[model samples]
Target: MNSHTVRSLAYLTGLIIKSFGISLVIRSRLGTGAWDGFYVGMAGHFGLTVGSWLIILGIFLIFFNSFLIKSKPNFFPIITIFILGCCIDFWLHFLNFEPDGAESQVLIFWVGLLFTAVGISIYVQGQFALTPVDQLMYALSKRFGFSLMISKTIGECFALAFAFLLHGPIGLGTIIFTFLCGPLIQFLIPRIERMLFCR
Candidate 1:
């Protein structure tokens, strides 16, 4: 296969893994990551699935990102968002695993967080389009001279506030995820990029 085909396959693989991570977190039933919390809360308020809300929010973020960057919105990322939304719902339905107790739930939540970190690292290393939420973070960082870490934290805070307002599930897991995921992703990115491209 050509290099492009290989890269595409890798990207898709990463996305599937990412979806599995998301589903695992959801099934843990402790709490969700910031964006997932917002999606779930919006889903509850709108009477739709979380994946549906993901798509809707993804669209809005795409436009918002365009506004921030002062460029024509790139619609390509919507393809990733649509596939990601479908994959999230598919994994959630397919896995059908649940933690039985508080200890088990905590264990599962950490595992899911690790999975999410690794999945993000792999997909980002693929150099394909980012999801709209991530794009927004990047735009903010570039436009305002904030570090990516700061932008991510700010974005998560906004998501947390929106989720809380909408009565989403918030707990220790949410707080942990908000504080740790960005740093973890930053730590992983360079290593993953080298692994992917240094071969």
Candidate 2:
């Protein structure tokens, strides 16, 4: 295989790890960040799997992002989300350990959170398609002439509102994770790149 193909496979492996971590976090019953919670909430209220909702939302965002950026919709990331969605379902199905107590729940949450962060670092650091939600963030920033921070805040607020409406788990974990996740991913990215010898 070509180097690009090898890199793509590695990125996909990272996505599988990330998806597994996401399932663990969701099953912990603590809470995830807004976008994830929104997907989980849809899965619970509607009649689909969490991974299914993830793909649906990702697809919806692809169009929404296209509208915002005034560009043609890129369906390439659908392939990425499809793998992620399947991996999430696979992990959710096979992961049979339920949290025995609050302590165990916390343990699961932290472990999953770390894996999620590291997996994100590994894949996102590579030059490849990212989630449509990420594209939405940039689209919003450009369309409204807002900064990335402001655009992300707007996206988070909208997602949080929708998650609340869906009765998704909105708890301390979500709040703490919102604060912790970005910095953790940022910290891990460079180290992971060095380890992987990626640019």
Candidate 3:
């Protein structure tokens, strides 16, 4: 494969790791941050494990993405995400990452969620196939020429609403994550890209 392709794969691999860590934190059930709050809530309502719900969400996004993005959808990230979710579920099942109980679990959850945002930034920097949520923003941006920030805001608002209707966890953490994640991802994307690909 070309250097570009190889770099993209490496970045995707990193994303899986980061996503898995976030999943692990969620299953710990101490406390979840904003996005995780929604995810966990959806899982609870559906009687699905958090990891399974994540995989389902990723798969659903993959389907939605085919119609939403400039780039043709690829199954690699979806497949990778599913595998990572399963792996994370297993890790949480067997490992005790949170020993201090609820409060400490919340601390770890936030840390993991931050890392999840960072992971997504790195993955995007790879410039591989966009994930579903990203694809939606991309489609909107291309269709209306919305700024990236604007498109992202629109998408997040929609996600917030949907998650809320599903009784997904919306709280102070959700607001914090919604506001901070965009800027944080924006900051990390370029930095990780430069660090890894020197581009």
Q: What C-alpha lDDT do the candidate models reach, one value each?
A: 0.84, 0.79, 0.65
lDDT by residue (tens digit), candidate 3, 60-111: 7776666665556667667555655676667556665444676765676677
For candidate 1, give the lDDT of residue 125: 59
TM-score of each: 0.94, 0.86, 0.74
Over 4 Å off in model 3, which ranges?
A: 1-9, 24-35, 69-77, 94-106
- Model 1: runs farther than 4 Å from truth? 1-3
**Distance from true location, Cα of 91 in model 2, Å:** 0.7
All candidates: CA RMSD (Å): 1.5, 2.5, 3.6
Summing lDDT over every window of 10 consecutive residues in candidate 1, give the lowest-scoring window.
Answer: 1-10
Tell me the lDDT of candidate 2: 0.79
The candidate that achieves the highest lDDT relative to the unseen native structure: 1
**Clash counts for all predictions:** 0, 0, 0
**TM-score-sorted candidate list, best first:** 1, 2, 3
What is candidate 2's lDDT per residue for 99-181, written digit by digit as tens?
A: 89999888888888888877777776556877786666678879999765566556766787888899998877777666676
